[model samples]
Target: MAAGTYQNWRDVADLAMDAIAKDPDAWGDAGAGKNCRSRLIYLYNRRTGQLVRTQIVIQLSAHQSGKSNRIITAYPRGHQC
Candidate 1:
C-alpha cells in the first residue's frame, strides 16, 4: 500500500547509501554547498510486471531563494506556485 505513493524513496535511498558507502568522498563532498532536490520517476512495461524506478536529482540555482527555491514553489501542479 505504501508503494502506491512513494516507491522510489526507498529505492533511491538504498542506491544513495550504496553510492556513499562505495565512495564517501565523491558524492557528499561534491554537493555540499549546492542546493539539490530528489524526486522519483516510475516506468513500467506492458510486457513485464517489473517496474523501473529512477531518481530525478535537480540542482537548484543560487539565485532561486526565499522559499521560491522549493519544488512546490515553481511546480505547475502545485497550488502554492
Candidate 2:
C-alpha cells in the first residue's frame, strides 16, 4: 500500500508472500515489543516501474505452538533498491 497502487490488500499479500519465499537482501532483529525478525526484499513495483526495497516483519510468537509466523506488516519503501 505504501507504493500507492496495489489493487487491494490481497495484492499486497501476494507480493509479500513471494518476497518471503526468496532469499532476503537484508534481515535482522526487529527490536523489543515487535516482530521477532524483519526482512528486506528487492522487488519490482508495478506502479513505480522500478525495483523497490520491501520490508516484511514476522511475528514468530503470534501463532499457536509456533506452527507458523504472522506478518505484522509488509510495505514498499519509498526508495528504489
Q: Against the true structure, whose lDDT is highest?
A: 2
Candidate 1, residue 58: the lDDT equals 28
* Candidate 2 Cα outliers beyond 4 Å, as residue runs: 1-9, 33-68, 79-81
The window of 10 residues in a row where model 1 has the poorest summed lDDT is 72-81
Backbone clash total for model 1 is 0
- Cand. 2 TM to true fold: 0.40
Best by TM-score: 2
**Residue 80 error for model 1, in Å?**
24
In candidate 2, which residue pairs clash? none
- Give lDDT tens digits, candidate 2, residues 1-81: 435443466775665555554644444445443333334544456676776545543322233353336555555544322
